[model samples]
Target: METIPSSDFFIQFWGVRGSIPTPGKDTVRYGGNTSCIEMHVGGKRLIFDGGTGLRVLGKSLLKQGPVEAHMFFTHYHWDHIQGVPFFTPAFREGNCFHIHGALPADASSMKQHFCERVLHSNSPVPLEGMHADLNFYELICGETFKLDDITIETRPLNHPNGAMGYRVTWQGHSVFYCTDTEHLPDRLDENVLHLAREAEVLIYDAMYTDEEYSNPKSPKYGWGHSTWQEGVKVAQAAGVKRLAVFHHEPNHSDDFLDNVAIQVQEACPGAFLAHEGMIVSVV
Candidate 1:
């Protein structure tokens, strides 16, 4: 098994669920962690989001010794930034991290968001205790940057309070990380298609089913989430080679997801739901 994450290009899902952590017998198969994903490309480690799942990924990284990584945030939602306090690697002295994210629409700097909200003074874990060499970078949506030979692109996502999608391409292979975004009711998102166009892998936000999203009694409209059904549509339109359905609904159990997974395959044979510990290779 390819256990180590040093592949030329690959992704590992440490936490796959959305909104909140759902731990219990019912959620075992699909896992309950929220939002963290790790990707290794061109000899650099890149992470997306810092949900509860990041704590687990941190533990694993400890065994690999001193660390250097780049972490990106899609938005400042509680579930997405809640795991920073528990990430062991961030507290270790010799490690380094370059954190990246756009300023929230409210104009709060990423640093202020982390210090004031995530690592609050009231919390037991203080920012003072984290000894890692943390570097903060301002990432603007619609901008493109390069890390050596790797090209990273960003796009604005349709979400409340705003979120950003990322497209990383290296050696002609690409992976799209599009989460916490909703689809247009009538047309495919041009920005989403631009990033996913013929990409090797696409990890998308599929936090609700169409039925639940439109449930008359419990509607999820304006929830800033998309359905697996919409994911299929985007993948097909973008000619994505494989689709990884992500950001699972918290209320969904393993069995519920199993049924959904089956349906996903029926709709798009190569598509599968993202799960804790699931790994996908892009090149």
Candidate 2:
């Protein structure tokens, strides 16, 4: 395990889009990749989700030489795990990765799901054939764990097939990653509030605008995504210092997101739209 000096913490967004990868001119500003985030805390390389952005992150890790990483999954949805096969480090002999996630009720283990994802029918390369040393851990929701000097807590989120939210704390600074989740109307989710309470940063799912989420003709109420408006409410209730509006809807273009950012700022002055390649310091 890697250990950084105390109080050193940083987060980088490799992918911010939700549902699927949307590569094209319309999405160039925010990004086309799905949900992947990289956090460096207490000198450890901690990754949240393995979406399409993981491929690019893997290449960057390779350039830095052999590495040992801990990757946590929010769920096993296609967009969240689709980049695993393209993660170059997984094919490298000297690299290693410890995968962690809450297994679904139907899945035997995290390893099984990963193997199934890379099976002959789904991927060109097989998980068994990967050169990197890989390990898997099935995390229980609400459990707390430690990596070096960093502390991590997990909570179940409201989403079809189930998902997890994570809170990471190091040297008193904290960051919460909450995505692919739906929030109930009129009240903040206690589970999410617990993970986000007083944190330095909160990265949340804001996949739709309030208008889109509540559109009578095409409401996305049960679509398992929330809007930035809700995110602001959560941030305010949790007393978070900064809010990162994440999990961008696939069809939302750059202009639309710009408007969303403006709205988010007006609602929550400390909040900003999460975009590919954006870096934030937790302290």
Candidate 3:
């Protein structure tokens, strides 16, 4: 129901699943690729995460040719960074990409993680094998920086090994991307709420149901995932214009997502499940 100018701002979901890629008949409708999102804001090409979906996005970018873009990673988890080696654009000589994120404890810098992931023992093609002009920036949590015409604000997320949540603003419109985060019971995350405050869209982690998260026999409290219920609460508390529930659980089929959507809509009319190839205008 919300819209942005056709020429300036749009967000597209290339993948929406969490934890793992589950490509099959059951996930076909919503998609099976893990955590990649593309945004075109003020003519800047920005990508979030590099999950398996990035492979598909890379193929599309190849057809366009001579691509230049900035990619922001939430974390270096396998499900989030596994597609880097398969991204065709990274293999192209003329393409340029800047990788941005907070450095993991195990890695000295963002570039180091990229290198290690593509090492001889880990991946067939080493980091040197990629012909693209790649650059990496290690950012601190709670830092504010600029990329082209967009202003980006980063916050630390409550995930193992740490993740960063980003808020990108341009031309008075803002969208917050927060995934792989766990929420504390009965309280909104001050960091997430700060980044999401009054934003046009809040694309958040809704990887579990409240019931599943609270299951006594199998509690997932510290597993670094949040529920749709928590997402709705944050949206309401932050006064977000829309809530795009993202980073779905791998086992949650289309029917399961539909039911979750219904529940979200009933509690907050602006909330909806994020689906692959879905475009959102953030104006």
Highest TM-score model number: 1
Candidate 3 per-residue lDDT, tens place, 1-283, comes to 1233485888988889999999998998889999899999888899999898898888878779699999999887888877888898898898999988787667877777678753325776778778999998988889999976799999999998789999999988999999989998767899999999999999999999999999999999889999999999999999999999999998899999999999999999978899888888886
Which of the predicted structures, 1 or 2, would earn the higher lDDT when compared with the native? Answer: 1
Residue-wise C-alpha lDDT for candidate 2, range 202-271, written one tens digit per residue: 9999898888999999999888999888899899999999999999998999999998899899989989
Candidate 2's C-alpha runs over 4 A off are: 1-7, 118-120
TM-score of each: 0.96, 0.95, 0.95
CA displacement after TM-score superposition, residue 128 of candidate 1 (Å): 0.7
TM-score of 1: 0.96
- Model 1 spans with C-alpha error above 4 angstroms: 105-109
Deviation of model 1 at 85, angstroms: 0.5
Instruction: Give one digit per residue, the lDDT tens place, for model 1 in 1-283.
Output: 2375446899999999999999999999888999999999988999999999999999999998789999999987878987888999999999999999997666568788678776777667989899999888889899999988989999999999899999999999999999989988889999999999999998999999999989999998888999999999999989999999999988899999999999999999899998888888777
In candidate 3, what residue range of length 10 has the lowest lDDT sum?
A: 1-10
RMSD of each: 1.5, 3.0, 2.3
